[model samples]
Target: MQIKRKLTEREQKLLQILINERNKGIQEIAQLAKTDIHDLKTIIDSAIDELDLSFLNQNKEIDCTLISAYNEKLKNIEHAIDRLAEGNYGSCQKCGQPIPEKRLEALPFALYCVNCQKKKEEKNKEATQRSYPMREEI
Candidate 1:
């Protein structure tokens, strides 16, 4: 069996950063969820009083989109925290290489190293291009 290495000072700092960011994200998501509920209540009241539905749908859609984004971000942060717990926070998920400290500082939730990330993005782009081929000029 392999032994786990002790966390360095920098790794400790990164763990703290991740924990702080996760807490902050949780608070933001909670606030967003509360606001969404309030907005829905207000939209229903306004729609009933004004007998108009245009604003209701638009407002709900925007709120849902915002909440969805926050939830996705929170998920990423949580995943990073899990990786940290697993003793592999700084390692790229795709290649098992350590991600640069600068990159981690900038994006604590990054799952891939720069090269791996680029490759993944390029592959995604090629797939998207294939699926949505441009039409010839009319």
Candidate 2:
């Protein structure tokens, strides 16, 4: 069986840096979210019969959002590492085209060429802006 080649020096270094940052971010976010869970509960208990439960819920919601975002980043990093292993780290996911080196330098985990990314963003924007349920003619 043919041995697979390792990632290039630059790609390997970028991958390591991305992984390190992702791990640190996930740990920090999880710690903060966990602390907030206790802190908010304590605040609710210490209140003098006028506790706004929404405060704790909102805090939890924010923590959840942050956790989700961090997890998404971690997944992206993982995908990037997989691509690197397969020797196609800088190719667009939507279209089989090489992503620009500059784009890769800016976003080491980018999975699409600029053109495809922009097109996707535009499509998403349009979908969000579309009005549904047209009124019947009066």
Full-model lDDT for every candidate: 0.66, 0.62
Segments of candidate 2 deviating more than 4 angstroms: 1-4, 34-62, 94-97, 118-138
In model 2, residue pairs whose N, Cα or C atoms come closer than 3 Å (at least 3 residues apart or on different chains), thus clashing, are: none
Q: In candidate 2, what are the lDDT values of residues 58-93, reduced to their tens digit?
A: 464456656556556655666666667777677788
TM-score of 1: 0.55
- CA shift at 38, candidate 2, in angstroms? 20
Quote model 2's TM-score: 0.48
Minimal lDDT window, size 10, model 1: 44-53
| lDDT (Cα) of model 2 | 0.62
lDDT of 1 by residue, 1-138 (tens): 122667777677777777676566556644655545455445433442232334435445346566556556655766676667678789889999988878887888788999999999999999998888878622
* CA lDDT, candidate 2, residue 91: 73
